[model samples]
Target: MTYTQTTPDHDAGTPGDVGDVVRLLEPDGSRLADAELDPWIADLSPHELRALHRDMVLTRRLDAEGVALQRQGQLALWAPCRGQEAVQIGTAHALAPGDFVFPSYREHGVLLARGARPEGFMLAWRGEEHSGYDHTTINAAPPQIIIGAQTLHATGWAMGAQRDGSDDVAVAYFGDGATSQGDVNEAMVFASTFRAPVVFVCSNNQWAISEPVTVQTKYPLAGRAPGFGIPSLRIDGNDVLACVAAMRWALDRARRGDGPAFLEAVTYRMGPHTTSDDPTRYRTDDEVERWARRDPIARFEAYLCAEGVLDDSALAEVAAAADALAAEVRAACIGATTRAPETVFDHVYAESHAPLAQQRAEYVEYLAGFAAEEAR
Candidate 1:
């Protein structure tokens, strides 16, 4: 299961070690023989495969539109997940509706997979809302931007689920960079200690901002979980079938009250960290070009086509669906409106607090002063 690269820069060690990475699809668009992982997706029919492809395409389309909106100054920032669609969409689709998902800011694909509205999803990026949607409605949390803090949130939720004697699992999605944060480690400790029904999914997209993953840890990111008494899986994030199988396996473990599971989805972020980043200052074109060849959507499409599940009309239909989604999301983002400044004070506390109340009054008075002065 060794993969050969034309470039010498592509190392053949742990990163490319097929033994450690669960891959069901090769970069060449052929199915890799993975007997252990095959049964997880064996029940998938041709229609289901087509649906997965559609989901990936639409996720990419939404992500592309988000980037464009950022570039056009409609959004304050956009975290592009261009090359990681398979990991997000595939994993997300494996979840039960009652399960909860905590995602980092870049999980546009996951949010879409969970059936969150495009307009609502755009609201956060547009700087119009603190969160994109009502989290409870989707059984998910708003995108967490505070590094690895969401891990703690997911862990806490899982603990509560454990106490309630429910089967729902909580999943936390973060990047390789977040692994360096103390909050992530603490969350892992709590998750393992309580035997919480949680899954920590680390999307190891090589670089965290400007630093490579090697800078964060000497060992494989998945290797860190075992020390906490949690089992881990290192999987090819670009392979849709692999992602789906891995997530199902992890979720099954969590539902069985087997403590926590850690999954490192090894993929690459094709675009900048966000619209504000300039990747050119650090990474090379050759590296980007190499990863592009393993694009998840392209690989999945090839697999479907080869399997006789996808044809010219099917491809056309998916493309049209993506185009329609992009258009709808674009319109929604453009039409999104901001709330009044006073509304910010509304959700600051569950009960009336004197200090916040005083500040709200002062803020109103301060705004009124401008109106009074304008009368002059």
Candidate 2:
């Protein structure tokens, strides 16, 4: 079956076309109507809308705490998800419990929505663990550090699900920079050819480290997927309602065995690429200020308030909840202790091998020398 484009031809693209983005809520907090996308989120009640706002608020607080911790030398590094809260929270909310997610290192909002503990979220960044949480427990893999590698992993898992005759879909979340990686292209090739049940979400935050996205591709990022035979949508990543609708639409297609779908969420990264880099060196304050006005949480909050779904009291409650969670995260991160150095050798082999046993013994002995020297 041929994949049908969900967006208009004018919006989908030509070589020079900058695709018209799909949006439900304007940057100014006004709502727009889309016949094709509206029904996907029509069932969302006022309570659910309020909940989305709360999730974004909490996610931002978590991001803030992460940045502060890294600055204070608690976390080794942190990828701030400052301006992309809507894409993460909205897509995450659309996901079913059984759907698996393979996320890049910046998707803290996704991890939080997946019910991952805040303490667990900090483990890897704290340099205390290889993986923050068990993939089997949450149906989501640990945040992948290698750019675009998770796309291949998600495609492989989607193929596995197809072979097992299961309708379960695998979703891969990556940044715009990952699209330039060969692994992402190869994964798309396999996914399209095999008609694997997968959704590829590209959060185009307009920057890949010190480089701007304009240098990454001349055409819209969404246009690249169609060449691989996957239908794609480009949406306003800052608009939570648009995100929810677009993700639900893609998820439905995958569940129906229609094959893989791609979504490009156009957003801006309002902070540095990571705690280790200085964004000011690459981007001008004027540009940053322009994007700041389009902040995802503020936009969503405005919409909620306009709709009478949220009031000053409700906003205060959300703020209190966010503050409490931020405090919990800070305390947990600060109090976390590193594991015994020797334990690193424990999981190398499931069953101990003779060589591994010998190595472990030598390592333990090596550590003992430090203890002896300290005693002296």
lDDT of each: 0.87, 0.89
- Models 1 onward score TM values of 0.93, 0.93
Question: Mind giving the per-residue lDDT tens digits that candidate 2 earns over 161-231?
Answer: 99999889999999999999999999999999999999999999998998878887876788788888899
CA error at residue 245 for candidate 1, angstroms: 0.5
Model 1 misplacement above 4 A: 1-20, 350-355, 370-376
Could you give candidate 1's per-residue lDDT for residues 22-105 as a string of tens digits? 899998889887776787788888888888899999988998898899889889899999999999998998999999999999
Candidate 2 residue-wise lDDT at 212: 79
